[model samples]
Target: MKRQIVTLPLSLMRVTSIDWDIDWRGAPEAGLTDGNTQVVMNQVPRWVGHLDMTMRDDWLRSWRAHRWQAQGRVGIYRLYMFDPLGFNLQAIVGRAVAETGIPFATGERFSSGSGFSPNVYLEAAAAASAGDTYVTVTCTDADLVPAPGQIMSAGDWPMGVVSVEANGDDTYTLGIQMPLRADMAAGDLVSCMATGLFEVDDDLAGAAPYGKLNRSAFSVSFREVLNR
Candidate 1:
């Protein structure tokens, strides 16, 4: 897997909020161009994101020097936006081109700030044998058990968790959508997601801060390269 961990410009004191949009194009049925008669076909889904965070001067300086304005014109950079949430791409190209370069941002309030959807991960408490419908798992204080609707895998085979039953002591039985492809042993690795953000085709778009304040904030926008 080609991936890199990027620390935030600053450990965001607080993530005021994060917002994003997925756009689609609709073609009106052209027989008569009726306003209500349009087929809303989702085009290649493109994601645009915005983040608001409490910033630090050091981080702001770093952004200005490297990320926000690497060159006179903004340069492209890979952003691992959701590693904290485990939404990462398992495989990526080292030099995948981003779809767009950083565009300029107009900071309001001298304002700012910030920064994949991937398979999910579930912890294993106990192992299971072939033909067993339920599997046990040990949750790492930070880990969660496989939940219904998430596709999980042990070895190379993948199966969806259809149901989950909590049995106490951090142990849970996961009902897979399909029969096990092979027996899972205790301590086996299980996961439904790959790690890393979607590879981008172009450099990330850049935003420049308008004014300096004790606390900094700015917003950068970009499109993630799509991988299916």
Candidate 2:
């Protein structure tokens, strides 16, 4: 079923932590007579992980305004999750080293350059299945290829790049950190910094009661919800 995507604005809460559960399954440790474990599977092990986030806030105003659509445990939650490798777009090759006036700054103001931001993305050279770990990137900037270990978002699915290889025909292949969770059609866009769905725990719906007025401290957690 198609789920309503709930995008949270930054005014709601500031992100503190994104702890990914990367404890993937592997061959069983069957002890051998010589004190060694042995097991095997035909298919190469694929990486799978659960995404998590801890957002702290006490803003009753924002929560009350959007709780009907944002808070859930049984439904799918589409959120603009920031990856660890946040905002790795085009390299700011030639720019003045003026620091951004985030939080507080007394010096000069920062300037973001013009034109479309340099993005390392391409149409799928070939279709990929859900369990596939790689896709052929085609017709994009060679100078903007995804680096190894960088996260790339295919629509709402974000996966890391495990490997990169140039096919010599302007089509580069990207090996994903985790196996693809859904099928990709030819010409699908793949890039970094996107949204995905999640599931919150039933018992831990919102916050734990409250303290004094005008201020409260608590964390809201989210678990990645994958498609079947």
Candidate 3:
């Protein structure tokens, strides 16, 4: 594949919130005689996203420069949005927890422990056809597992996690919010979706009071482009 697709940095996802929508094809139509109007709809859909982030004025300045470098409103940058529900993509502690405790003279004990879930790579375990809701995947990352509510992409097709079930053989079955859009093979990359890709095809406008005070002050618009 050509390197036409540019991946945005994860640091760009410091958004306070996002306003996402699906831009499906539609047209207003009216009966010639009665003048009754109706919206003619085509189910072809694309993602329309609005991002709001608070950052230093310098950062916002650089963002504007980046957009200018792209010739304004004509750039394809791959963006990855984070999961809304916290810890849904984080590592889950196993059924056991090991802690070392020491008794103190104050009648209080000190127990120190640690649990962290860093980013890890993932892949599918079997070939799956388009329209399949769940796909089996294997993760070599120890103590870390994919969880429900995480949004990910496979073969460049976006999907959200609805369920995660373990198969007892070091593999997992993940139910996706949207079924596969195309067939995928075994060993294909099943990203946990910490990546970024945003195509700028619209105006980058926002009302950032005092540089970056309001929640929606610094906002950028992105439109998902599949074949643009």
The number of the candidate with the highest TM-score is 3
TM-score of each: 0.40, 0.61, 0.64
Candidate 3 TM-score versus the reference: 0.64
lDDT of 2 by residue, 1-228 (tens): 555666554334334545443324556667889987786643433223233223323335445444566546545555544444544332333222211112223543223211221234567888999889888878556556667766666777767777889888978888985788789998898765445556666645555354455444455666666552
Error of 1 at 133 (Å): 20
- Please write out the lDDT profile of model 3 over residues 8-90, one tens digit for every residue: 43333557886654566577665566776667876445556787777545444544444555544455666655454522332
TM match of model 2 to true structure: 0.61
Q: Which wins on lDDT, candidate 2 or candidate 3?
A: 3
Q: Pairs clashing in candidate 3?
A: 77-197, 77-198, 78-196, 78-197, 78-198, 79-196, 79-197, 79-198, 80-195, 80-196
Off by over 4 Å in 3: 1-4, 19-43, 84-119, 140-143, 194-197, 205-216
- As a whole number from 0 to 100, the lDDT of residue 2 in candidate 3 is 39
Q: Answer with 1 or 3, whichever has the higher TM-score.
A: 3
C-alpha lDDT of candidate 3 relative to the true structure: 0.59
Cα lDDT, model 2, residue 152: 67
